[model samples]
Target: MRVLVVEDHEELAETVAAGLRREGMAVDLALDGPTALERAEINGYDVVVLDRDLPGVHGDQVCRTLAAGGSRARVLMLTASGTVADRVAGL
Candidate 1:
């Protein structure tokens, strides 16, 4: 599967991408929200591993844009906040 790993943390992003690659999946890395959106626009990704608190556009906005643009890629949002409210809000 083709996956986009979007995280502001460079090391984490690279590590995730590397792990996905080792799993025999095609992976791309995006450090921030805007870059993630740009890459998503240019590439057909099966999944997007998105960081919720992104630098440029924010993960929710990125997901919204993708949905509005009719992208079929699945989005998995990650966040440091583990609160129930945060999880519900993200959903």
Candidate 2:
């Protein structure tokens, strides 16, 4: 499967992408939300591993844009926030 990993944490993003790659999935990394949107437009990714608190554009906004744009990729949201609202919003 092709996956896009969007995270502001460079080290964490690369680590996750490397692990996914080793598992045989094609993975791409986007260090922030705007870059994530750009890549998403250019690629037909099967999945998007998105960080909720991203730079440029918020991850929630990115997710909304993808859904609104009729993307078929599944979004898996990541966040360090402990709020119930944050979790619900991502879902």
Number of the predicted model whose lDDT against the real structure is largest: 2
Off by over 4 Å in 2: none
Task: Please write out the lDDT profile of model 2 over residues 34-67, one tens digit for every residue.
Answer: 9999999999999999998998999999999999
Backbone clash pairs in model 2 (N, Cα, C under 3 Å; residues 3+ apart or in different chains), count = 0
- Clashes per prediction? 0, 0
Model 1 root mean square deviation, Cα atoms: 0.7
lDDT value, residue 88 of candidate 2: 78
lDDT of each: 0.94, 0.96
What TM-score do all the candidates reach, one by one? 0.97, 0.97
Per-residue lDDT of model 1, residues 1-91, tens digit only: 9999999999999998999999999999999999999999999999999999999898999999999999999999989989999998899
